[model samples]
Target: ELKVEQNPLFLSMQEGKNYTIYCNYSTTSDRLYWYRQDPGKSLESLFVLLSNGAVKQEGRLMASLDTKARLSTLHITAAVHDLSATYFCAVDQETSGSRLTFGEGTQLTVNP
Candidate 1:
């Protein structure tokens, strides 16, 4: 069975600070993804960690993957109030094609 989990499911952050979100899985897979969502809004893709050691960044957010350890991380740098949102990590089992198993999202509140 494949399982995905994220830590610090509720985060209270201050502007200009840095933090890291972790994603752990119970199975072997090379595909992982990160997404963000505003309250009552749909998810927005942040990064796709396709292979081991793969890293991606956009603005103050960075994501990396380690398939061997079944782990992935989303790093936040110099957070701002506008960056407050719920973040999620998802994994794709190659045999399942387009199906994705998502983690319980991390809700981030960036206060100034």
Candidate 2:
């Protein structure tokens, strides 16, 4: 079974502050993904980590994965009010077909 855990389930920071959300999985996974969801909105894909040491960045957000450690991280640089949303990390197990196990989302609130 694959289990995922995310820390700091709720985060409150000022605009321009930086923070990192971590995801740890109990079993091996080949693919990892980061997603964002606004209140009353569907999830939006943020990043995809396909291999070990994979890293992707867009705007003020960066995501990295370490397959060996079964860990993934989403780093937010200079957070803004617009970036306030629920962030999630999901792991894809090959044996599970297209099914993905998601971590408990982190609800971020960026204040002025």
Candidate 3:
């Protein structure tokens, strides 16, 4: 069965600090995605990595894909209180479009 796991389900981050969130999957996936969700708001897509060695970054967030190892990671650089939110890593399943198995959401708190 396909599964995804994330480290430190709850993170207390300090301002201007850097941290990396790890995501590991159990099955093969052609695409891996990262998303951020603010309280009471719909998720905002962060990164989409396709193929091994794919990487993408925007603002202070970066994500990478390693298909051979069935892993994907979300790295936070220079975290700020404004960046506090819940993050989720997801990957397409053997099924089809937008059908993804997701990790239990990670709650990130960036304190000033």
| Candidate 3 lDDT, 1-112, residue by residue in tens | 8899988799998999999998999988898889899999998998889899999989999899999998888889999898899999998886645688889989999999
- Which rank order by lDDT, best down to worst? 2, 1, 3
RMSD of each: 0.8, 0.9, 1.1
Off by over 4 Å in 1: none
lDDT of all the models against the reference? 0.93, 0.94, 0.90
Sort by TM-score, top down from the best: 2, 1, 3
Comparing candidate 1 with candidate 3, which one achieves the higher lDDT? 1
Clashing residue pairs in candidate 3 (N, C-alpha, C atoms within 3 angstroms): none
Task: Output the better candidate (2/3) by lDDT.
Answer: 2
- TM-scores, all candidates, are 0.96, 0.97, 0.94
Position 75, candidate 2: lDDT: 94
Clash pairs of candidate 1?
none
**Position 32, candidate 2: lDDT:** 94
Candidate 2 residues 13-46, lDDT tens each? 9999999999999998889999999999999999
Model 1 residue 69 CA deviation (Å) reads 1.3
